[model samples]
Target chain A: MIQHLIVLPVVLPLVMGVLLLLTRFGSTGLKRSASVITTLLVAVVALALLLRASNGEIAYYALGDWQPPFGIVLVVDRLSALMLMLTAVLALGSVIFACGGDDEKGSNFHGLFQFQLMGINGAFLTGDLFNLFVFFEVLLLASYALLLHGGGKSRIQSAVHYVVLNLAGSALFLIAVGVLYGATGTLNMADMAARLVELPAERDGLVTAGALLLLVVFGLKAAILPLYFWLPRAYAAAPAPVAALFAIMTKVGVYAILRVYSLIFGDNAGNLSALEQPWVWWMALGTLVAGTVGVLAARDLRLLVAYLVLVSAGTLLAGVGMGTPAATASLLYYLLHTTLVTGGLFLLADMIGQQRGKAGTRIVKGRPMTQGGALATLFFIGAAAVAGLPPLSGAIGKVLLLDAAEAGQRLWLWPILLISGLAAIIALSRAGSTLFWRSQDGDRGGAALPRPQWVGVGLLLATSPLLVALAGPVNDYTRATADQLDNPDAMVNALISGNGDTP
Target chain B: MESLYAITTGVLSACGLYLTLRGRTFPVVVGLTLLSYAVNLFLFSMGGLTTDGAVVLDGAGDYADPLPQALVLTAIVIGFAMTAFAVILAMRARGDMGNDHVDGRTREDSEESRR
Candidate 1:
């Protein structure tokens, strides 16, 4: 059974999604419990997968016994396993929060949410490029539905822009994949890496174009500077739970860039080695600047949180742009901190909005919350963590990335990243004070938030301190993951050997 | 023949992109459809375009590469679903916002200098 653990992340959610769809007319409680239990199970399994991966072994599960370089395979390295765990945890939180009543507002909420998980997990795990595209589409399919869930005029508007942009992105993804396949005659990433090492000079131009095109697709996913205009509006308008799930969605793109670039075009691939680093650096810095501006400019709490996602993306991309194992490790740590905290903040925003009556998540003077004290407390911790203040995960994540930067890169990275951190502090404190302290005028406070909602928010927000507490082990894991990623030969060999796993 | 195929894909993509940039959702949906069709054709040609080639038979002489065909099939299915969803969403957006404009702004709003 453990032998099948690799495929479990993809299959379990898929099966559960179908089950939820079949029982679409059943009690909402059934769907919620079933979905939460399955997500928790996947989380546990993801933990096991991470443990198996911790030992620095590259493993793969080939579907239908079709061997690598020929058939589709799901590869589980430290990075993919770590992502599976992150996605599962985030899904658990979002699903629970949805049960607070958002799920009831839309049809197939649980089902589509599960399918989204399946797509995210599948994207993280797949070794085949085409399979990755399939997962991207799968996740997009679920997201487009979930984005329009509990449809509002703003949602439909943002969904139109989001859907149109992503459709164009999908077309670009297919073209990139096709170009790469035509050039390399293989879609398996490790295989592609191996082939890239020996690829003829004549094919270099084709490969370069394909590789860069792939970067464009992943960049859109990562919401880098130019391509990120759609993110804040779409995220701000999404149902809070769906928006939280999207916290990991951007990380999916960052992971692809990390995986594809570091593995296929690493130091071994002669001319194409680190081809994307220069592009990524400039884009990352630009994105960082843009995010800082967005963070400070945001008026609504949800929109502010959404811009924080952009800030995190910029920081993570900068780490990737630095192009060192230390930078990769640092970025992975930051990825964990940002994804969870931002997700918690999205849920927190909803909670605050609930209590504000007409004020509704905007940073304005309004009625105080019924659960004012608890909400303020959560907001305080979340703000401190997200702003890169001391005694939390965000500060450590930032310090590690800064420490990892090379001298020449440091000149560019330090000021921008620090300023972005400062921007976050300003925006978050402003939003917090407005929501908590300034709202003394109106006497409207909704009923106390639900039990599940608190539990859900607690699950995600609690991870910040936990991340700080667990920093040692987590950093070690990320460093090892980076080391594993920096060297692609192990994966190539592992795939070539049909068993492709630990003995 | 290969040039013709490439030209067709290029023209379709150009038209699709132009239409996609239009302010209205209907044009945007139609543009996306054209774009997907172009992508489908491009994917089909990725396996080294063959006029008379068999993908199913094992070890057949002059056989077409089966992988690209399989890939194209997946892309087509996904594209179809996306187009269907986009079409429905466009209608819903029209109903909700009282405009088919992509940003849901009225024609007058776009034409007017200031609100």
Candidate 2:
């Protein structure tokens, strides 16, 4: 049972998703309890994995007891464990939020949600490139279904663009993998990295092309400039709980970039060393600027929050571009803070939209709401946290990122990051004033917001202050994760490192 | 033989890309299908372009690389499912929005309909 812990994150979800699917005719109360219990179990498993990984040991569980480089392996390190924990907690919040009546609009909501969690956890845990692609499809399949849930004209429109763009992206992903495999003759990332170190000079160009192709694929996922046009509409049109769960989807792309580059193309890979640096650096800054402009341009509250996710993506990608352990640590900390808060904001926006009669989430004047004061307080806390105002998790995350940037990177990161923060604050304040303060008093018409809604919003939004309080231990964990990532030799050597390149 | 294989894959990919760029959903789905075929072929050839090789690893000369075949199989299954989903989505988009333009809008829909 103890040895099976590593695979539990992936397998438990698979089993639960299937079980939930079988109970399609079951009561919503039963389904919700089942999903909530399963997510809680996943969180507990993730916590255990996190604690074990903190010992700095790299262990991989081979499916079917198959050996490395031959059979699929699920590698657990500090980073994977951290991401798994994040996914589980975020999923828990989203699932609970859905129980507040979002699930009733669509069939198989609980089932699809569980499958989405399965795909996400699998992607975080897998060590093989091909396996990663499969998990990506798993997640994409689930996301496509979830996106169209409680469908409307707008949802249909956005889903078309999202699906088409992602299909292209997946094709590109396959081509990249094929190129890498042809050049290195292995799909296991550890094995690929080991072979790359001693790759004959003839294959350098092939490997470089593969690496760059991979960057394009991940960039599309992370919603960097030139590939982000699909994100805002798709995210904005999605149901609130579904959109909140999607907060971590971009992070998956960021994680892929970090993992592939650091492990396969790191210092030991000879000519391929840090080849992703310049491209990611320049593109990341462009994304930061683009995200800020979007924030200012946003006319809808959901669109604004979606743009905020983009800003967070850019900020994290900048840390990736910096290519230092300290920067990695800082970005990890920021990742934890940003994912939870943005997810909470989406749920809160839904609550606010519910009470606003016809204005919905559009950033315009609306009639007064019964829970205006309560909603205002939550909005203030969320906006402050997301915009990097002091005494919140966002401020701590930004400071850590700023401190990690050295002289050269600081030149660009400082002004751009600071200005983005100011933009966020300005945008959020304008939105808040239109939402809460500017509204006229009348009937205060709209159904009373449900209890589960408040609980769900609180569960996610409260993470901001909690992260601030637990800054020390969280920072240590992130710092350690960074150190572990910086050293890829441990993973490669533990795998089939000495077997040399395949034919 | 190698050049022939490479050229075929390239042409298929080029056609797929052109199709995907078209204004309608049907052509786009066909294009994605074409592209996936190209990808599967490309992935298959990655193991090497051997015609007559041992299927299993008997430790003989030119034993076939089974991994790429396995990979192509998975890709085909996944690609098939995606194509099916894309078709259904296209149908639904047309049914719901009353048009099959990829953006769910036709020319002269008025300014307010535009994003």
Model 2 per-residue lDDT tens digits across residues A22-133: 8545788999899889999999999999998898878788888778888898989899999999999889899898999998898888889989999999999999999999
List candidate 1 stretches off by more than 4 Å: A23-25, A442-444, B56-60, B113-115
Q: Every model's DockQ, to 2 decimals? A: 0.93, 0.88
* Weakest lDDT window of 10 consecutive positions for candidate 1 chain A: A494-503
TM-score winner: 1
Candidate 2's error at B87, in angstroms?
A: 0.5
Give the local distance difference test score of model 2: 0.93
Q: Going through the candidates in order, what fraction of the true interface contacts does each contain?
A: 0.93, 0.85
